[model samples]
Target: MGLWRVFYAGWQMECCGTPFSVGDDVSWQLLLVPGEEPASRLTGPAGHVAGATDGIRVVQEAGLTVALSEDPEPRSAGAGPADPGPVRRSGLLSVETHGGAWPEVTGRVRSLHIVVQDLARGADGTWEPVPGTRTLRETDRCPKWFRGREFGTDTGRRRRDEQGVLVGLEVPS
Candidate 1:
């Protein structure tokens, strides 16, 4: 089961984005979410896209990075290999005991979709969908994303802060 399926009482992850949307590195740079706010999404070779997810209420914009690494990094202490989830370790380098074992791990992204729905926390601190928030779900609530055969670590995003300050960060999974 997916984390969404585990946490969401009733929700769905719909994919309307094709290989043309975010997969084409030559074309896709930015796209606006289909709605009133028209949230502009900037996707990269990395595992996440940055955009405005908050609707009319809060103006909070965030990046939802996905886990995309095939062979995770060996620990500094060399504990053990971890599951390929959110490890953020992808590049043209490796230190695996079986060196270069993941040649197929181009660290490239395939496709992505936004899980649009509101979460409600009860007194027990469990997450459930609000009755009204269910109305927010859609076939394309957020633009579906795809990736080319690019290394996830090879790309990053340039972000400007509230004060118009600019900074760059690696697009991690």
Candidate 2:
């Protein structure tokens, strides 16, 4: 079993994700993001995002296919109806990246960890986790994202649903 640290975001869960627990067999669409991407560091300053937790592994790295749409533009662009085209094997994995669906990774959850970080906007307009405000809470269930009055409304200081699960998943071969 290849153990890897996978970051699952909170909004992704609240949108189309289901609550999962340790030892539960689950499948999720995953995007292989380059570590250089600023968003990739969602898991802390060490590169943690407000809602990303680590700890996912892969069984195989190849032999995967992702469904893609031919038209990359928005439907409102007067591009007529959208077509989901055909499924193609993603050899480079980075070929034709878009905002839609991604390849699904399936596996059993080996562990779960929730990440909580208090973030404040800096003078440079970048958000960073506050000192001593980063904590990883061990949980069996993935929590849902919620919007509260105290969230993102305090003069540059606000609480966010930046909680996520570190699912140990098996990337399809």
Candidate 3:
């Protein structure tokens, strides 16, 4: 069996996503993201032991309708505006890395982790996660997305953990 940590974003769940629980068999499009990416901040260490999957430690649950944007780093230094690419409503999600296709992961949920984080006002007047305020709670039921208006983002409270779901899945070889 192969164990993997999967990140299911709250916003994705709130936006027409089906909720799943522990022990449920599921197939989801998984994006292989580098550990240093911004979105990887929400995930735990990778558990899959595939040799070619290095640097793809973090996997995110990709929605059917995904928003595409131009690669930010490759833009010219003086580009006037960043062009947000057209929305892809392909109803399919997948990624290819190292000349291999990683379309979806089929597995049984072994465990669920709800990520909780404590937020503090940064010097720049933005809410940032406290250095060590991250914790995970084991749960069986999928999370419900709570709308938060304070920071113009969902789960806008100082101390919140009910938004993100980190699923531990066991894939059969």
Candidate 4:
């Protein structure tokens, strides 16, 4: 696991419904599932907006992926509509891969994007999607092999909407 210091510019964010602001000194702990490793520093970026500051994508693993600061754009799959936009990844989120049980990160709801899909499995081996969320038309909508349950910060990774149930990931801007 890796540790990181998060900096927000008072953009109005939350973790699992708990509101927070700049200078909060939130601790971002990055944990990778089995066979996973950090592709780069926890403070390094995976990518950035067309021309914005480059952000870092944290731990990378085969089963689970986590990124700190990056940009993710989720598109509509089949019946799904266009992704409203990428979420601001001031906060990091990630999920266990390989269809294993991943405990939801307990925090305030991220204001930017929700990183979950419709066919996600809970830590208890249940097919649970974000509440009120429908299934994704296909896996193509997600980054690489991630199912619909993947979520990231507004800057890093993909999209989905849920409270503290967000997952941080990395991909192209």
Q: Which stretches of candidate 4 lie over 4 Å from their true place?
A: 1-24, 34-111, 120-125, 128-173
Candidates sorted by lDDT, best first: 3, 2, 4, 1
Better of 2 and 3 by lDDT: 3
Against the reference, the lDDT scores of all candidates come to 0.23, 0.47, 0.51, 0.30
lDDT per residue (tens digit) for residues 84-115 in model 3: 33322111122222232234567888898776
For model 1 the local lDDT of residue 101 reads: 21
Most accurate candidate by TM-score:
3
Candidate 4 deviation (Cα RMSD): 18.6
- Better model by lDDT, 3 or 4? 3
Clashes of 1: 1
How far does residue 135 in candidate 2 sit from its true spot (Å)?
2.1
Task: Give the CA lDDT, 0 to 100, for residue 10 in model 3.
Answer: 73
- Deviation in Å, model 3, residue 115 alpha carbon: 0.7
Give me the displacement of residue 9 in model 3, in angstroms.
1.4
Sort by TM-score, best first: what order? Answer: 3, 2, 4, 1
> Each candidate's TM vs. the true structure?
0.18, 0.52, 0.54, 0.21
Q: What C-alpha RMSD separates each model from the true structure?
A: 20.1, 11.7, 12.0, 18.6
Q: Pick the candidate with the highest lDDT.
A: 3
What digit string (tens of lDDT, one per residue) describes model 1 on residues 1-173?
Answer: 11111011111112322222222221112211222121223223332223312111111113322222232234456564333233222121111121112111112222323234334455676644444432222222123231112112222222211111000112223
